[model samples]
Target: MPSEPQPAPYLPDPRIETIAEWIGDPVAPAAFPRHQLRWHNRRWAAAVGLDGFDETRWVQHFGQFAPLPGNLPQPLALRYHGHQFRTYNPDLGDGRGFLFAQMRDAGGRLLDLGTKGSGQTPWSRDGDGRLTLKGAVREILATEMLEALGVDTSKTFSVVETGEELWRGDEPSPTRSAVLVRLSHGHIRIGSFQRLYALEEKAHLEALVAYCLETYPGSPPPPGAPGREEPAVILLHQVVERLADLAASWMVAGFVHGVLNTDNMNISGESFDYGPWRWLPRWDPRFTAAYFDHSGLYAFGRQPEALLWNCAQLAQALSMLVETAPLVAALDRFGPLYQQAMGRRFTARLGVESRGPEQDAALIQAAERAMVETGLAPEQFFFLHRAARNAGEDDFGTLLRLHAPTVAADDAFWRQDAPPGVLIDEVERIWAAIDQHDDWSELHAKVEAIRDLGRHLG
Candidate 1:
């Protein structure tokens, strides 16, 4: 494996403080009955210079909500509005979670340490601001698997089992409870801008645009892009590119985010907040992750559309600062960017060199058709025919023959009979070990195996 980056010292730079008071509200953490450290991501910890913390100190900061030195004195449950399944709702914001702190990674990229099930906030409404232990475990698995599959996603930084019994209708009643912290690129969502737009807060909207351009620093829009020099247009373009790549990564990984609300669409474009997520058991595009999504609005196939719709809403917000035409031009970039990203990521997943866009697209279509026709799971298909091997005389085989192999299928990960996967059944099995016998052995093994796959893929 490549040498890990030297850990950066704990540098607290809560840049969000500059945005003023209206952006968020101060909130208190819950008084948990107990704090038992369940999961500590040592790899990410080492990357951020927090690996030196012993178990006691780790629990105090992450579980007990003790403020890290030089960080925010109080958590901020950010204020925002979002479209929940196409219905504009002004009453949406952080309820169970809050921005705990902000720090930089070894590479100087700003990261947010955000919480889930930490406590209740004003946005909590009538619902309890708590996360079930099963929910936390599911999020950990989702992040781990998505990261291994080359998805730019949040890192599950910590999962501490809080001694509490919570009742829920979804699963067994009075289930275990926990608190989670995720390390993310940023927490600024599309809905963040939407809130300002809805309120007609033009000055605040411009300030947000400026702040994002400085802190998140992205490349300007493509040549000839309308209003390419405008900060609002540029921010929109950056989000478009990031989200397009995010959608492609999910498509290639066979991941259904389950919920694609505007609030869930992070400006950093990294995928986070995994709830009711699923991986395709077969190559079915209509696969819906959330059981409540009766209309398949955010189904696996419609993810790109949902994402584009969210981008449109962002364009609507940016219109508060810039001309509608320029923002529309920025939104226009999503389609081609998504197609290009899809081609690039698909080739990487297939372990093959691209034969240009047209050929790549053809190969992708053929491979999808083959998977659907043969009823093969995506993981199985990629594992069985990696590097263009094991492909018989079918349309898929013909397309595979056209592309050059990128890696020989000889690595230990490839040699395994079955690839490391996080399908619902596997996730339930891992959780079952933890729930039934408190045996984390299976979960730990799965994480290691997933990392091994990542190493080989690299």
Candidate 2:
């Protein structure tokens, strides 16, 4: 029998030249074989503007991409300071990762194409610029799942399994390495601003602030606008609003980012790193995901507070760029913004038709208490709640038993003929929307409807 040859990798539009030309970086000579990697589609990457990125070729090229003409990303060795695990660490920048370049999407949104585990550079410091295959796979799964769950997150553009083996103390010996391309707004962290503040470089801090404002022009100006005197207060307020909104989103999704270090906090307010992150299965306020979280600093219930703390760090850093009084006042708005966001999130999740702060609070508290007392998995309960209108009590009982066995004892509680609450009507509305749709489109449309309702009610 004759043997068949493998197919060549599909090369999409050779606009790689355009991307290269934009960055002025030459494509490195080394090329990883496409067969040696796991390729996944990034909807957001397509939503942005990246196309035809060969993860395998990218891994093979490694650090050589910097010197390639028309392909070299305008490399910036960012300077940043951070408090890692509560202690100040002044010398952490792009330890291994680097921002390759920025590209404008069809919608005119600027997205940064950055590389992780692309090998060592001047900032590598006593570490290897490599990411484990397991780490890469975990990141891919995390990104996909989070996006589906509607969490504001960075998209993984590509993942390439390099043929070379590396060693890591955290796992078994001779671990495989991989490269990850992430599409994000920018990599400018709170630490980046802090670094300049530490050096007392007011000019640089102001420059960074200006750069941020230019990057995210839609951001509302702080208290004092065009004709107003103090622009720093306005800038501070804008940052506070974005930070509050991001924190609220995280809380709504039950996401615990193991590390909330200043370096991990993005000024543009987007979830970036997936390291040591976990989605809460149940509504436990104390759930911690990161193994090294000895102090319970970044727990599920504490995420909002942790974010406020990070925002405080940012405020301190911005003091170098703005006045102290306005920064403090701007920072004060964190509580109100978070409260409003939380109210909106909870409202949607419960499908409450009427808006009443007291009523909403009571409903949320009741749900939380019921979830905890019943030991129900948060996701399962919410999923069942979304389907409750048509599925009937028995169906919900079956689902709860299948997905969250701990709540089996409470089947009677869930099935009891009680008066209709906020969730009941909401569930009925969501189910009605699903019922009206055809079978082929019902499942997807239903899930989306529930999610949309959750967003509005939350």
Candidate 3:
């Protein structure tokens, strides 16, 4: 019999080189004391034609940072500046991570393989560039949960425990260290443009804009939208639309990203870099995910506002390429787009068909009122009323009855009394099983449960 056929190798696409050299700094990966393979995203690995890698090859490339064939010979620590909590900070960049390689997925869409804790770079500043093992685990859970909930999010590609101890004020002393690799559409951020604008690199900024438009093709701004013909204006419009949808998705999922800095906002509008994130335990707009967020600038209820504010920063960057009027026109689209997105995503979460915008808004209002009056957690409320069933004979029920169920009432996911959630408590519980007992059963089970939830939602 003939031997089994081997899968074709993935072709690397180092497209970031299309931009000027000032955009990034090439650097070396840190030497690790050990490389213990922890988590491998076989599903996504298969998408990028890397599923055949064994543990040794996986550790060698991901943990040891050995350059992949025909890819970036040296990792590039990306450069950009952003406002951290609304304060401009020009000192920011890829302090702890770098672009490892680029490859097209099975669909032929360009994707990036970036690292989170692979090592330090010029942007490390006064802090050491190391990620705690627990942090990596939390990121895995966050990405999985977000992806399940239909958020456009980065895929946590790999986690390798590097034998080292790291000290941090927030985590336990001398916590375990690890390196994480994430797969994303692109790593260019709104702040990347801000950096170019700040440096007065108008020519480089224009090149970057053109590169973005070509690499991440988006629908042209709807006709009659201001400056729809201008490249900068078009990119701004696409970013606004994508971010609006993203903000709505998070609201429907009851997620608080904890941080909404301009740097954290991806140009592709994909959610990444999970830090201090939390899901709403109850329907409260003032719910915050970060302990240090004293002002609640990014509270659950204000996520849309925060995202719009970040969009304004992007507009400011693009001002160098276009007039302010068109950018403002693009910015003005966020409100209408966000409302529409909220209606659509909210109805989907409830497993009901949309009954037009006005009726959808009414249903959403009724649901919110029900949550407040009944004090039901968002997950519990959604699960209980999935397919618009079990809604009490109240205003919410009346509005829900106006819409038809999108899925069978007897669907497996809807049959459960509670929705599968990766709330903070669950995260801590899963981490405890790993940290104290070195057991991974809970983590593995939770991932499967989340995926099941995704399938049912579909």
Candidate 4:
């Protein structure tokens, strides 16, 4: 673990008068971990004007604020049900999480600001609504790493240790409890819409659709026949496109959301709920993050399909709002949109200029086959390929030889044009540029350059 930093001073949002004003009630304090008190996220706090809210006094009086006045949407405790790995569960909503409030950001973007592990709420079921320190740490790491990898993701707002302990059957002793605040576009899930549709709540479904369009009008409407009057159909189409783009982005970054349940699928299409997630070190399409995913439904390569299925559920929910023919037409666009995004990403990763479908497919298949046969880590291969291209054919030959020992008969083919002595010199120069300092900004720039070449080729 990295050395923990001390808590920074609070910087309140200019839009918010106080914490109480933001939440409608005195913000409730829930104690869990002492070590978890370290919230040294000054940059993020400053970005959202939360630097003024980082004070120790505010920490002590977290649950004591009066409601803040604003155009912030009222965050009702929404109701919804979901299928956990294909098994239907009737009771679920804000389980161990709650939408604290919704507010527009500095960019005039509507975002739902919520807290996980705030406290036990109506949907607590048999367990506490508190999060473990381990969970918080993992989320922090995920947010930072994923953002660097260029994925659209939720950002962590704040983390606080509540100085309490809770036990679960998975662990021998009780773990420390903590609260985490996350900033997202909207917390409404595909399941929220699905549940209403399932229960034949047409009025509520229409209201939800209307709310989404009003909140996120910039999003594209359904495939054909657009207008505000067709809010339900338009909203459904918007969700499908978002989900397609989101899934493609995940695939491009070699990310596995692990769980793609309807409840985990955000209508905004932004990646949310970073639980049981993993990044691929190698490009195995079948790789999965969740150990219990026996069916391989949400495997690395199957994310797009899983998203389509989830969209289908959303479409079913919207049936009450639109006729079947238009709904099917809207659903049809998912495949093409997903493929387009995937094609762009695959081309970007390969350092090859993107041509059309044939060229993209050939390059993608070649890379996939090479990775599987050579047992080379995807990142390692990508780095080496970029280095080879930058250093010329001779240096590339040397890289192939260096990595050759890791493969089998392929070594003979790769070593045919050995670049002799100069390869190491070129590699060292590039490596120095990449690893000269511990600062990640310099490192990320180098990686982005390599990605840029691929995009240019595409």
Candidate 5:
């Protein structure tokens, strides 16, 4: 955990100030304040102008829920309704976490500092709202891997191990507890609009749509499309494109975002709130990350389907206030958009550029067939033919040679005996060291290695 020297002071500028009614009143953080700030993401902190703060200040705000100067005076538990496993559930919101503060990044995009296990909120059904230290560690690993693979993802800004013990039905009981702060483009989900629709709050619903478009602005509407005539339709088109791009990114990265619930789908299309996430071991489509996923609904290959279904739910919400024709038009673009995004991202990851959708699609099919034939995980096939590093006379190698190199093959991480990967077994081994002996040497080393992979991919 290297520190940022001579960082700037923290300041808050609330761009989403108009929609305060959507947030629940702030409650006090749980009294489990041992204040052991374990991991701080200096990369994100610097971008958010938080690099100047010391560790103590970090713990006070992130761990203890203290308000930052000029920031939100109180934390806000956001309100939303979501569908879980194809079942619409109107009783879900921020259960264990809340939006602590809102600020802007170096790119001037609005960012929300939301928590995972700060404490219970209005939606705390029947469980204690505390995060296990292992959970925080897993998310750190997830975001690191996703970011390295160029997947749009939320950055784990800070993690603090609070002095508490939690019992859960999932992991071993009496595990240590921690708090995680995530920096995202926006916390508003498709579910947020659903909640407003459920309450029959048309004005609030339209307000949310307006807020989202203003905060997370997207590209101009497609040339003279119907969406150009309506702001809500325009927003829907942007979301559909983003979600399509997000789904393709997951496929190219070999990531299974175990749960693809409506609540987990950020309107900004950034991936966050990782639970039971796993990297693909092989190019198998039926690989499911969550153990309880008996139906394989959110499997590795079905990720695009799940995302498209969630997008339909968003379209459904927007339909309440506007006509369905333009929204459906936006939804229709998802298929072709996904294909193009997948081809572009897949080729970029393999260090090439797409010729056109047809040629690119053929190349993608050839690459997948090659991976499937040998059961080569992305970690193997990508680096095996990375920018002319290990080209061969095979079809896949010949396909690679046709495309000119886009990146210099100077990274030792890719040339090493084993390319960087985040399989479940590896994650468990890293966790076992900490769970048994509180030794984070392996975890720290993994973080550094993942950073190197990010640099290599860049």
Candidate 6:
């Protein structure tokens, strides 16, 4: 009798390989992957088939620049050109990062593992390819808080303290450096298509469109778009829905992703590359997140506009391959999608099932006005109103009474002395403790508290 054969060991199934040629440029990471391990997302690792990976295995794949099994043979530095602050910048790309690998998540969705501060590439024109430790810390915090707020955002997969000191004008000089790995939905940015259009590679552009539609599948096209089946028009419609959700989600989360460049906008609608991001201290529509955003282009309330503009650029790129009418029809759906998504998200964040879009809109408007008049931080606003907590207060009484009664705030989280806040001052204090004392206890404590908040929000 013959014994039954056993199946081979589990390995990640990837899709990036199929379109690697037309999408990315093969490149090796600069220098050795010799960074000291600092933080690792063990939970995500298990979902991606690297659960048992030790320090060596982890650093080899993430820090030491070694390729992973069933993944790309070498790292790929993706090419993209974006309209930075309404100005066309052909020189922009992955200047300090590259696509490390791609894998499927537990839910069978494709995910990308990308690197930041691994090394420089051809796009590293005049910059030192490095990431400040503060930047890595900030990204981890941003993602954690955003996820807690139910925003579609990237997870900081790993943080390795690269043994290097980098100088920059933004932060303190001689600052520590780190290499970060991010696990995300996908790395295909809207700018990726812009580059193809700029090069006049219609064939590559079409191929890229097909690859995107097949890879990052989104909602079906709207009813009015006659060419819903057309690859280019369908993709345009899908990206519109996604970016609309992203913009609405951010508005509900009180987040401002300072840089809304076309390159920063992902086709999958997941938020990543957190630079100069901020949560609103109060409900100020004119609040700007970036220090140099003199024009308030990507201000807190204007996020939807910025995202809509980026999607418009994507539509413009797709125009090179498809007609204007269907694409334009798809583009027209952004405003309505944003409005409805915002209503839904706000109601959910308030811990109430949305009764109707109009009611939800009214509640959101009332809440916003109350917060602005009372000078309440967004976190405090949401926390205090968790199922309409403190509903009897002068600040929120009438506003909350205008709606159907919400679930009572019976959870222990509502009884907490104070809710967690990661505003700029709070973030600065966390960083100050690290910089001045070299102590990370506060950072670890904050992350734990953030997870606790997520649990409470559940």
lDDT of each: 0.89, 0.59, 0.89, 0.61, 0.84, 0.83
Clashing pairs in 1: none
Instruction: TM-score each candidate.
Output: 0.98, 0.74, 0.97, 0.75, 0.95, 0.95
Candidate 2 overall Cα lDDT vs. reference?
0.59
Q: List the residue pairs that clash in candidate 6.
A: 33-64
Which numbered prediction scores highest in lDDT against the true structure?
1
Worst 10 residues of 5 by lDDT: 1-10
Residue pairs in candidate 3 whose N, alpha carbon or C atoms collide under 3 angstroms: none
Q: Give candidate 6 regions above 4 Å deviation.
A: 1-10, 32-34, 393-396, 402-406
lDDT of 1 by residue, 227-326 (tens): 9999999999999989998999999999899999999999988899999999999998899999999999999999999999999999999887888998
Q: Find the 10 residues in a row with the least total lDDT in model 3.
A: 1-10
Summarize candidate 3's per-residue lDDT along 359-399 as a digit string, tens digits. 99999899998998889888889888888788678999999
Against the hidden true structure, what lDDT does model 5 obtain?
Answer: 0.84
Looking at model 3, residue 36 earns an lDDT score of 94
On residues 304-386, what C-alpha lDDT tens digit does candidate 5 reach at each position? 99999999999888887888888888888899999999989988888776778887787788788888988888877887767
TM-score attained by model 6: 0.95
Q: Which stretches of candidate 3 lie over 4 Å from their true place?
A: 1-9
Please identify model 2 stretches exceeding 4 Å from their true place. Answer: 1-35, 52-74, 221-229, 350-354, 387-458
lDDT of 6: 0.83
In candidate 1, which residue ranges exceed 4 Å CA deviation? 1-6
Which candidate model has the greater lDDT, 1 or 5? Answer: 1
Off by over 4 Å in 4: 1-36, 57-76, 219-229, 349-353, 387-458
